[model samples]
Target: MSKVVLVTGASSGIGKAIATFLSEKGYKVYGTSRNPKNIEDFNFKLIALDVLNIETITTAIASIIKLEGKIDILVNNAGIGVTGPIEETPTDEMRNAFNTNFFGAIDVIKTVLPHMRKQKSGLIINTTSIAGYMGLPFRGIYSSSKGALELVTEAIRMEVKRYGIDLVNVAPGDFATDIISRRYHTPLFDDSVYKENYKANLDLMDAHVDTGKNPIEMAEKVYKIIHTKNPKIHYKVGGFLEKFSIVLKRILPDTWFEKLLMNHYKL
Candidate 1:
């Protein structure tokens, strides 16, 4: 029997790429979107899901398990981004970001753990980003939420090791995806000090993503991860500068690294 895989936020972008790749490769794959009707053009099975909705998650997982009898892979790829000055960013937007990016992943994991533990074999891939590595100038909330997710993935790895479950955080650097259009910016006030700077910074950020690696690159990485017997705890995907930035963070002095980022964004 083929391995059964479930990926969240599969309606478009990276999630869709992964689901399509895996399905074509013969794995039984299910892709998720809040509106199932929207995924009809996709190759894999479509499952309606709103990660923020516990009931939706519960029903989606149950429906998958009922058909496949097991979930060998769970990809937490559903997330939303909020951009702008952290201080001016509304509390609700920040909460929505965390709710969708962090807690949604947590909820899905909680729901799937029991089944995976019973089977005693599974892979859980959490799609994070380069932003998680450092706080950006205008995209503080989105970066911070992914940073929280990074920590959550780390802590859960140790807890799930004995259960034969492999958890990895895939931090892709600015992949081209629908997330660009879907991104939510904190309300920008014209009279605010951050208005002009935030506009420029947000545009630069979008340009980076618009020109970044394609989703297929990350999808290919996920395929390799699935085939490997022992995958790394973290997989960084993207071009030289983006992936290398993580290396620099590790070896460079804190002040130097901080200044580099600040200067890059003209903060």
Candidate 2:
């Protein structure tokens, strides 16, 4: 029997790429989009889901279980990007970002964990970002939310280890995705002192994503992760610069790393 795979936020980008690729490889793939209409011409099954809504997530999982009997894998890939300075970003705005990017993943994970635990075997892959590890100039909210997930992933690994379930954190660098279209920039930036520099820096961030790596490459990396008998705890997906930045951050002095990051964003 083919393994059942449920990929959230599969309407486009990395989520869509992973769903499409895995379905082609013979997994019984079910992809989620907030609106079924946006799923378009996809070979996999489409489920209506709003990751920020717990009830919708419950319904989606129930539907999948009703047909597939068991979920072999759950990919937590639904997230929104938020940008702006740390101080200028409203508290509510940051909470909203956490709701969608961090808590939403947790909601889905909590919903499906029982099924995986019952089966005594499963894989959980969380789609994090390079920004999750290092706080970017204007992407503080996005970074912190994903960074929260990064910490959760680490602890969840130990908790799920006894259940024969695996959890992985894949930090993707800038990928050519609709994330740019979907990103939310804080309105407060307009009235702040960092206006000029922030706008220029934000544009620079978008430019990198505009010419970023392909989503298919990320799908390929995920595919390998799914199939590995005992995959590593963490995987970084993106170019050499993206992956190496983490290492440099690890080994380089704090001031040096800050200088490099500031230079990259032209801050």
Candidate 3:
């Protein structure tokens, strides 16, 4: 039987690409959106699931399990983008980001684990971001939320290994997606000290996404990982410089790396 797959946040963007690609590849793919009805002509099944809502997460997972009898793979792609200066960004917004991007992913994993453990086989691929590897200007909250999830994946993978389940993080660089419009921007305040610089960086951020790689690249990577018998804890999919930036951070000294980023973002 073809593997049963669940991909959250599949209403559009990378999540949609991944879901559609896998369905084309013959997997029993089920995608999620906060409002499924709004999405029409989707190639695969779309379920209503708001990652921040535990009840919805549980319901979605249970419905999949009821139909498929087992969920062979889970793509934790449900998340929102949050951009702002840490100091000026409201505490509530930061909390909201963590709640959805971090805790929300965990909740889905928690809900699905029992079924996977019983089957003694499962693969979970998390859609993290290249930004998660470091702190970037104006995108700090977005970076932190994804970064936290990356760390949690590192820890949880080991804990779940004995149960014959695998967890992997797929961090992609900016992709041409609707995320730019959907992302929350902590307003450009008229009197804020960092207003000018923040606006510049925000435009830079938008440009990156506009010129980003196709979401299909990420979908292909996920497909490859699912087929691998032994996949690594982390896989990054993006252009050369974006992937190399992670390497630069590793080899360069902290201050030097920070300076490099400052120059790149023109801060």
Best by TM-score: 3
**Error of model 3, residue 77, in angstroms:** 0.3
Candidate 1 vs. truth: CA RMSD?
1.1
**What TM-score, over all chains together, does every model reach?**
0.97, 0.97, 0.98
The 10-residue segment of model 1 with minimum total lDDT is 34-43
Error of 2 at 205 (Å): 1.1
lDDT per residue as tens, model 3, 2-106: 899999999899999999999999999999999998556788999999988999988999998888899999999999999889899999999999999999999
Q: Clash totals for all models, in order?
A: 0, 0, 0
Note the residue pairs that clash in candidate 2. Answer: none
Cα deviation in Å at residue 236, candidate 1? 0.5
Looking at model 3, residue 149 earns an lDDT score of: 96
- The 0-to-1 C-alpha lDDT of every candidate, in the order given, reads 0.90, 0.90, 0.94
Worst 10 residues of 2 by lDDT: 183-192
In terms of lDDT, which candidate is stronger, 2 or 3?
Answer: 3
lDDT of 1 at 121: 89
- Specify the highest-lDDT model's number: 3
